[model samples]
Target: MTATTSDSTNAYSTPADDGASTASTASPAPVSPWPRRLACTLVVLVWPLIWVGGLVTTYDAGMSVPDWPGTYGYNLFLYPLSTWLLGPFDLFIEHGHRLLGAIVGFVAIGFLIAAWRGDQRRWVTVLAAGVLLAVIGQGVLGGMRVTMSARVLAMVHGCTGPLFFALCVVAACVTGRRWQRDRVLAAANHTQQGQITANPSTGLPADALRSPWMLWPTLLFGVAYLQILLGAQLRHALPTSSPSMFAHTAMTHVATGIFLWLLTWVAWSVMRGCGDLTLSRPAAALVCLVAVQLLLGMGTWIVNYGYPSILESLPGSASYRLASKNLLDAWIVTGHVATGSLILAVSTLLAVRLRRRRWVLTQLPH
Candidate 1:
């Protein structure tokens, strides 16, 4: 009887056995460097592509090369460096934008391969595939726009850029080390929704953050995206656009900009008061960037349209074009464009973090 009892207890698992079982089952996952690195590479490459596209628009150089999938009848990749480098400035920017876009596509392929090999999540693989498809579609649409002389297609292609940028950024956030670490922390704590209702430290009410993360950030992202599209319409429209249409878009851009600013500020306020640096810091950066973007909007107006027409009411003053958009104009406009993408990306990152964190909090093993 004594021997049977000892055998039964031993069969159940000694402390050491329990420790071994826990170690085997709960060992922290090895962080995959390639996936995160590839995602980051895509993010870096895509943003510059945005700037290059802006430059193409800035110089009215979209048709400088006058060829589709090629530069001046030469295969795009085979185009001579000497010709491109010494070419007229407009051709340089336009062709360079094409070349940069190709590079982004290639990097996207790399990211897809890396994610397939390293990210075990099936959804991640699907997302990478979607990104690849978007890149290919972007390339085709750009080529078609140039070949068909379709300005409307160009507007569509322009709008997709920011969305692609946001997608890449969100993927990077999900593949990041910190994101994985948070998952582990949540799993280790096995946090249940109703249990302990407060955050780890300070006993602060974490419920205060629920809506901020769950709903507000996402709403702000959509608003920013709409503003981007409106900005793109105004950009692609330019002097050739109907004056009334231009004025309406311009007014809409400013009005939406103010609305987006308020949304971001409110999000930041909620996050800052929530006492989570992970959420609060990004919220803070977002507000600052949005502020800078508003300022840049002003600069964009001054550079392109000159001082407001209202200023013409002054004594002996009249409305006039400002210096015909010099190189400074190009840089300021491109900076504004690039910053808008960055803001969009950052907003995406915030939304991903908040949504994931909320999921972690609510779905903790009960």
Candidate 2:
């Protein structure tokens, strides 16, 4: 009996390999769809986690529970729902954040299991492992922040959660059917490095891959993460921060936002020029996300700090005093945070697609 195996090209062997010649047209095994599904599910769950986390910070409710891996001496999952739901506003969001984190952790486990069992790619499994570890680390960070009452921990936790979410999104993309199809193309063009030779199949100059613009996606990915860190600095600004310190952090964040917006457009332009819709679509989406995020950043400042002095010259701006603990304020600020994560996620998707462009580009018809 012959054993089935997936090669580097994603081709599979039949059970009858007993010295008999097989047909040249033998079909490959179907890639399992569960890993992508579970990974996508994880992405969906993490979005709410980010929103809840942003709320915890917005309301200064990180210390409401003041315990680790438990809620007021009760097991995390066993916490009384009545008290959690009916508690003080701060307690409700903090405990609810914990519950959501736990849910995300469980889903991460499911995603990892699906990757291990179904996805043949070793890298996908490794990424799933990293995601699981990230989820656990994020939980520990949250608990430590609560137990130690440390604002620094809270900031770190906030920054890392989005990173974990980004990883989940990448996992979803890599485990996708489209990605598997690209693997087949990559296997064929695996050795086309630095070759000016036209790809006989696509009738396109293969030298395009050698361009420096290939690094744009990578640069965009870094800028996106940096923007998230900068946002964290502002979001978790210490109570004792001086006016100048706050101004400096805000200015840096603003500058980075502008740069990130420009970089996203550059990436989109590159993708469009190549006519790779797989990359172009996400790149375009990333451009839109960055635009919305910039607007949200402006909205976040207005809601949190009221209008800038320049805005005071505009009608109705003079009357804009930031309401303390306003509902709209909370939503705007949280939406800003959530949108940053979204931008990072979309950037990750585009970056991964670009890195895999060897196969993606090969599939494009001339």
Decoy 2 TM-score against native: 0.84
Candidate 2: how many backbone clashes? 0
lDDT by residue for model 1 (1-366), tens: 111112112222222232232222233334357877888899988998999898887777887877888888898899999989998999888888888888888878887888787765556777888888888988898898889988888889888989999989877876775564234234323333334345565555664544444477888889889888999988888457888988998999999999989988888877765556778788899889999999999889878877786766765446455675677888899889889888889888888877765654443334
C-alpha-based local distance difference test score of model 2: 0.76
TM-scores for every predicted model: 0.84, 0.84
- Residue 170's lDDT within candidate 1 is 78
* Span of ten consecutive residues with least summed lDDT in model 1: 1-10
User: Candidate 1 at 281: error in angstroms?
Assistant: 1.3
Candidate 2: tens digits of C-alpha lDDT, residues 1-366: 333432233432111221223333455557777887888989999999899989999998888887878888899889998998887999999988888888888888888888788765566788889998998999889888878888899999989988888888888877765554334244324343322344454554543654655787778878888888988888888889898998998999999999988988887776665535576688889888889988989999998888898788989998877678688878888999999998888888877766665544443443
RMSD for all candidates, in order, please.
7.8, 5.6
> What is the model-wide C-alpha lDDT for candidate 1?
0.75
